[model samples]
Every structure is written in structure tokens, then in C-alpha cells.
Target: MSYTPLVDAEGFAAFPAPAKLNLFLHIVGRRADGYHLLESIFQLVDAHDTVWLRVRDDGQIVHHNPMPNVPAETDLTVRAAKLLQTATGVSYGVDIRVDKRLPMGGGMGGGSSDAATVLLALNRLWHVNWQRQALMDLGLQLGADVPFFIFGRNALVEGIGEIMTPIETEATDFVVLHPPVHVPTPAIFGDPELTRNTPSLKVSLLEGTADWRVLRNDLESVAVRKYPQIAQHIQWLSQYAPARMTGSGSCVFAAFVAKDVEKNTSQNQANAVIFGLPKEMSGFVTSSLQEHQLLGFASD
Candidate 1:
């Protein structure tokens, strides 16, 4: 299919690749392939990385600012663009630039979101016009989290991150902290004690009256145990509200409802802890997104 690239006055376009929170993540089972079956509520947030794209007619994927030590071929954004080019045989290339905001290894789905953004943006920029399902199928080969970003909603995600049921969640304010550490996802999942048998949540229970706190990240125990700083940070945030680790670890978050996310300081109880965060720690407040910025780019 031929497509006219959505070039602007400058001949380029930019898109947002937002971060996500596993509002609650659980491991319900394991597959024989060594992939853990999961049940989680994935919430999109305003925290995002900006991806800049300029279409190239010659079909060469180039990263204007490739990550340090990571080849353009190795980066997810470039990989996504190349994957689309390969799959569709589109005689188009792209120049990719990223204004990265989310931290690496923070379990925030930053890379996956960036990749999804590339696919969605390039689909328009290159005019491939492939269906959303096709793009998501391609994204899965990149990472488990990539599909959720493409799925484009707060979702009830399961089955090793493949199955998804869209769910409505109240937009919430969250204070997210970056623990001065990195948590390896494989190590957390590989721990013998990691809970792989947590009971599944029925849609009725999840959509009904079940509190979010009822479900917790099964990987939390493994993460906090390996890095006491994770637990310590969670404990500190717990002083204001129930705090939980998002994804595997290294970043923890607490919800805040009673105060302004931007204006609140340590003077008020709701934000006291957020603004009074330890000097050794750094974090920012963000509100949950009801839907992904790319939701309409793909048809469900």
C-alpha cells in the first residue's frame, strides 16, 4: 500500500511514548516455555519519552542520537522502524531522535513505549496502513511490554503479557520514586521464592468493588529482599499512602488523591512526604492517563 508521509513544514513529526505502571502485577502461573503467566492492570501515565521522526524515502533507519554503546540496530525504536520496513517492504526510512525522560531498568515500559511509538508514528509517516493487530503481533517479538503500549488503554493484561481486556480506571496522581539502584528483571523472576502461584482475579472482582491494594506485585517480595533500599523507599512513601513497587523494582510509587500534584509541597500531609523526599532520592508526581496518545492510531 502506498502512503503519503505526514511531513510538516519541517518535514518531520513527533510523538509521545508514555510510561506505564503495573497498578497491580501478579504471577498466576507459568508456561512450559519458561514464560511466567501474569495478571496485571497496566496504567498509562503522563511520564513519557518524546520520539522525533523524519521520513526518509531511501529506506535507511538512522538514529540521530543512538544510546551510549547501544547500536542503532539494537535500540527498540530503530528496531521497530526496521521491523516495519522489513515486514511491509516499504521503501521508506526514518531519522529517529529521542528526548528520553524515563529511567532505564525502572520497570516503566519506557523502551517498549518508544518502540510502539515508532511503529505507530511510522505507520502514518510511511503510510503502511497495516492493522493494529499486525503491529502488535510484530511488537510482541520485541518485548512482552511492547504490546500493552500498542494496546493503548489501561488494560487487564494476562498470559505472559499477550491477553488484554480494556478496563476503566480513575485517573490518579502518583508520586514515583527512583531508588538509586537497578533491579534486573530476570533475577527477580528467577528467584526460587518468587510467587508464581498467586490466585487469578476474576473480571467481576477487578471491575467490581475489589480494591487495587487487594492485588500486589508478586515480584515485590523478591525485589525488596534483594535490594533493601527498595523496601526502605516503599516504607518511606508508605508514610503518606499505600506504596507499591511498579513492575519488577528499582522504582516505587504511592497514590495521592487529596492534593494538587504540581502545587503541593511538604507543608501539607498529602504532599509532605513527596516534597520532603530524602536528598539521596529523587522523584516526580504524575497523573495517570485514561488512554494512550496512540489509541486511535490502531483499530482494536
Candidate 2:
């Protein structure tokens, strides 16, 4: 869905804040701050949000949206703009618009990614001149997954998703499936049975795997237990590729190497399965972006 509103000032600047998959999340421990310490590989996907900004002469951040049901103040796009204005003390404001494609509460880091894109996009549009690290630091205050979008690469993340280490792996394509449901992140996180003490593994070890063995979502079992539909989808998808839950729950994905091969296989099997979804929910493959796109704005 598109949320287009003109920022009442200079022309706009735009950026892509892509969705991410926790290839594997290990909950190693908990911190004194009531936060769980984690180790995971966060892979950025082609899925993203496009955020547009226009500088304001009056030093006041004004966030607007053309979308019918979306509230302006509650939108992450607005919060992100305010965050940049507050942190840098730049004597300027921005008029903001967000073209959202990522699904909300899908464990795809949509909101966090949008926040990161705004922080990085505004640093340039407003001439804040903060380095990448500075932008990332500013992002952490907004959300845990925010920093990953700033770096814009597949990373080994720890410490509530802040600490990052860039890693290289053979690129692959994904077939993402979104069921018609929203899974609240807090519900999964606060579950008493959620494993909070998974041991961490080294990057060197994961690189040596024959298949995605050690790479698993720590919350998958809990999510499936809570939502039986997730378990059913996983069973359906596993017939094609090694499938798993991306983040907390709701959206599950399977990876395939060749499009035709995956297609032919999926076509042959058909019991209680839905295929050829409308453009919005259609399953397809995507590669990770080397970095988030920072460029011009558009509305539709």
C-alpha cells in the first residue's frame, strides 16, 4: 500500500529500507536490562519500503500520508523523521511520505527497516553528514532491528540485534508466503516457554554446513505451537525446499535455486494448497541487496 503526502518544502529524497530474515537466531542469554542477548544472521531481502522526504525551512518535522486508514502520528515514517530531527539538532524539518510494501508484524523487520531508511535518507537530505556508524547509532534508539537496515547487508547480529558482523555466503533466491494473519511480536517474545538460553555458534562453523543444519529460528517451535496454521504451512512448503519461520511468526519462506525447477515441483503437488496468488501475496524469489537504495521519490 502507498502512503503519499508532499512535504511542504524542498523537493524529496527517498531510500529503500528492505525486509530481513533471521537465517538463524540463537538466544544465548539475557541481560540485566530485561533484554535477551542473541546471535543471528540477519539477511536483507529485496522486499522494502520507499520513504520520501522534503526539507522544511521552519525546523519542524511534519509527517503526512495520503493513505485512507493510516494515522500520521502513529506511523513509523513520522517517528523516524522526528528521531533524526531530535538527534542531530539540525535547524530544519522534513515533510515525509512512506510507500509501504513490507507486511506489518510479519517478522520481516518492516517497521524497523522503515525507521532505518528515514535516518539514513535524512542525514543526507538535511546535510547532517553523520558517518554510517553514527546513523546506525541513531537508529538503535528507535528499534533493535534499525541498525541492520543502516548497514544494509547480511550480518551476524548480537546484543538485541545491534552488534553486527558482515558475512559473505552463496546468494540464493527465496519463495516467501504470507498467510492472511498478523502475529504480534510481543506475544511470542513474552511466552514463558520461549527459549532464552540457546548457545551461540561461530560464523566459521555455519560456513561449513552441508545444509542449513545449525541455522534455525529459535522461535519457530513456539510460534508453530501457538499458531497451528504456521505448522501446516511449514509442512506444505518443506515439500519443495528447506523451509523455516523468518522471525517470530506468520510469514514462512522456502528457498530454491532454480525458478523453473521450483515452479514445476510446486505445480505437480496440489492438495489443500493455494498458488498463483494475486500480485500482492504471490510467492517469488529475491536476492539480498548489497545496500539499501537511496534515491528519488515516487507515488502511485
By lDDT, the best candidate is 1
For model 2, how does the per-residue alpha-carbon lDDT over 1-300 read when each residue is reduced to its tens digit? 232334434577665678887777778888898788888878777877777777888987777674578677767667777877888788888887778787777789988988887777677678877777877777788788887887766777888887888776445566667766678877888889989987667555446542343468888888898888778777767776688988886888876443454455433332113353344343545555544554222110
Q: Rate the local accuracy (lDDT) of all candidates.
A: 0.85, 0.71
How high a TM-score does candidate 1 get? 0.92
Clashing pairs in 1: none
Which residue ranges in model 1 land beyond 4 Å of their true spot?
Answer: 1-10, 258-272
Top candidate (TM-score): 1
lDDT of 2: 0.71
Residue runs of model 2 more than 4 Å from their true location after superposition: 1-10, 66-70, 206-214, 258-282, 294-300
lDDT of 1: 0.85
